[model samples]
Target: MIPKYRQQFNQDFSQEKYSLLKEYLKQKSGLEPAFRVSESPIFLKKEFESKLIDASESIIDQIKTLSPDLLRKAVPDNCYVPGHTDKPHFLTIDFGICRSENGEIEPQLIELQAFPSLYAFQKVFEDTFCEVYPFLSEIRNKMPHEEFKNYMKDLILGNEDPENVILLEIYPEKQKTAIDFVLTEKLLGIKTVCLTKLKKEGKKLFYENEGKLTEIKRIYNRVIFDELDRILDLKTEFDFREDVDVKWVTHPNWFFKISKFLLPLLQHQFVPKSYFLHEFPENENLENFVLKPLFSFAGSGVNLNPTKEITDVIKDKENYILQRKVNYEPVFEDINGDFSKGEIRLLYIWRENDEPPILLENLARMTKADMVNVDFNKKDAIWIGSSNAFFAE
Candidate 1:
C-alpha cells in the first residue's frame, strides 16, 4: 500500500464527500448500490502491485497445465454443460493482504472463480471515487474509459449484433449485482435476459426483446448452477446442458473447474493449504482452518471455525473444503484509527488467442470482520465495504 496517498485521502475525506460519491454513483447507474461501498480506495505501491501480478501469474500458469481429466471431472454429472470451451474467458482471483513470517506485506490467495465479477461497475466506481476526491485522480485510470468499453465490446459482444447478445441471469433485476448488468447493457448495447424467459426452437434459443422474439447468438453468462439448482419451482424452456446454437462468452463448466474446487490443487507461495473436507488430515488442527462450500456464493456456507458437528451434518463431504486461515494484516486504517483487513481481487480477461488472461482491473473489500461478506461486518463499521484499488504509476 502507498502510505502517502492513503494518508492524504484519509485526511481529506469528509462525510459530505462520501454522500456526494453515493449520489454520483446513483445518478450514473440509476440505482443505489445494494452492497456497501467503502469510504476509501486502496493505494498500491508499484512493488506491491508487481507482487500481486506475479502471484496471480504463478497460479495461472499452473491452472493452464491442469490435467484435462481433473477439469472434466470437476463438473458434477448432473450439472455438466454442453459445448464446453477449452479455457475460461474470465477469471477473478482473490488474495488477502497478509504479513508473512518474514514481516513482508504479501498477498495470500483466498479463493478464485472463473465466473465474471463487477467488471463494468468497478471501473466506473473507481472513476467516481476519484471524482469525489479530486486529489486522488493522480493515480488515473489504468485503462481509459473508451478503451475499456471497446475491450468489453469485443469480449462480450464479439462480432454478433448487440441485440443478439444477452447477459443471461436468473431474475437479474432482483439480483444484488444487477448494477453490473445494467452498466454492461449500457456499455455493450446488450440486454439482460432472465433464464426462465429463454424460448427454445430446436437447437436455437430465443428471448423476448422489446416485444419481439429475438434469436440469441451469444450469451454473457451470469447464472450460477448452485443458485439455479435452488429454484425448485422454476421452469425454463432452454437448458444449459443442451447443445444450444449460441456462443458462450464464458463456458459455464469453467465455473466449477477453476473455482474453489481447484484451490486445494494449487501449489504456490500465495495460496493457502486447502484440502477437501473428505481428504482433510485427521491429525491436523481444524481450528487453524476455515470450512467452505465449494459451490456456494457470497460466503453463504463459510464457517470460520470448523467443528465435527458441522462437518457431520454435511451430506456432500466432497463439496466442502478446509482451507488454512490466512491472517489478514490490518494494514488499512480507518478514520477512527481502527484498521480494516483488505482482500484484493485481481480481475482478468483471457482473449481467445492469448496464452494467459490479461489482468485488467483490481477491486478490494475492506472489513473488520472475520470475512469480507456483509453478514460478518458489524453494524457500525466504516471504511469497510466494496472498494477499488489504484496502483502507483
Candidate 2:
C-alpha cells in the first residue's frame, strides 16, 4: 500500500465527500447501486501491485501448462457448454492481504473467475471517484476510460452490429447487479435481454426488441447455470446446453471449468492450501480450513470453520473443498479510525488466441469482517462493497 497517499486520503476524506459520492452514483446511473460503495478508494504502491500482477500471471501460467484432461476435469458434471472458444474472453483474479511467516504483509489469492465482472460500472465509478477527489485525479485511471470503453465494445460487439448482439441475463433488471447491466447497455449500445425472452427456432435464436424480431448473432452472456437450475417451471426456448448458432462472448462451460473447482489445482506462493473436501488429508489439520461448495456464488455455502460434523452432512464430497482461512490484514483506516481489510480483484480480458490475458483494470473492496461480502460488514461503515485502487507510480 502507498502510505503517503493513504495518509493524505484519510486526512482529506470527510462525510460531505461521501455524500457527494453517493449523489454522483445517483446522477450517473439514475439509481443507487444495490450494494455498498466504500467511503474511500485504496491507494496502492507499485510493489504490492507488482506482487498481485505476478501472482495472477503465475496462476495463468500454471493453468496454461496443465494438460487438456487435467483442465477438463475441473468441469462439474452436466455443465459443459458447446463451441468452447480457444480461451476465456474475461478473467478476474482476487487477492487479499495476509501476513507471511515473518509478519510481513503479502497478497494471498482469494479466488479467480473466468466470467466477466462489473466492467462497465467500474469505469464509471473510477471516473466519479476522481471527480470527487480533485487532487487525486492525477493518480490516473488504471485503465483509460475512453480506451477501456472501446476495448469493451471490441470484446462484446466485435464487428457485428450492436442490434444483433445482446447482453443476455436472467431478468437482469431485477438483479442486484442491475446497475452494471444498465451501464453496459448504455455503453455498448446493446439491449439487455432476459433468458426467458429468447425464442429458439431450429438452430437460430431470436429475441423481440421494440416489436421487431431480431436474430441473435452474439451474446454477452451473464446467465449462470446454477441460477438457471433453481427454476423448474420457467420456460425458455433456448437452453445453455443446446448447440445454438450464436457466438458466446464467453462460453458458459468456462465458468465451472475455471471456478472454485480449479482453485485447488492452483499452487502458488500467494494461493492458500486448498484441497477437495473428499480427499482432505487425515494428517492435515482442518483448524484453519473453510469448507466451500464448488458452484455457489458470493460466498454462499462457505463454512468458516469445519468440523467432522459439518463435513459429515456434505451430500457430495467431490463438490466441496477445504480452503485455508486467510487472515486479512487490517490495511486501511476508516472513519472512526478503525482499520478495514481490503481485497483487490484484478480484471483481465483475453482477445481470441492471446497467449496470456491482459490485466485490463482492477476494483477493490473494503470490509471490516471475515470476508468481503455485505453480510460480513453489517455493522455499517465505509469500505463495505465496491471501492477503487489507485496505483502510485
Cα RMSD for candidate 1? 1.3
Whose lDDT is greatest here?
Answer: 1
RMSD in Å for all candidates: 1.3, 1.4
Q: Write the per-residue lDDT of candidate 1 for residues 1-393, one digit (tens) a residue.
A: 577888889899999999999999888889899889898887767778888888899999989888889888789988888888888899999999899999998889999999999999998898898888888777866688898888788888889999999999999999999888888888898999999999999999999989999999999999999998888899889889899899998999989999899888988888899999999998999899999999888888899988889888889899999999999988887789888888899999987988888877788998988788766888998978999988784
Residue 38 alpha-carbon offset, candidate 2, angstroms: 0.9
> TM-score for all predictions?
0.97, 0.96
Residues 1-393 of candidate 2: C-alpha lDDT, one tens digit per residue: 577777788888898999999899888887789888888888777778888888999999887877767767777657777888868899998888777888877899878888989888887888888898877788866557788888889888999999999999998888888988888988999999999999998999999989999999999999887888887898888778888899998988788777888788888889999999989989998888888889888888888888998898887899899988889889787657788888989889988857788777788888888878867776656667789888886
Which predicted model would earn the best TM-score?
Answer: 1
lDDT of 2 at 181: 88
Q: What are the lDDT figures for the candidates, one per model?
A: 0.89, 0.85
In angstroms, the error of model 2 at 235 is 1.6
Off by over 4 Å in 2: none
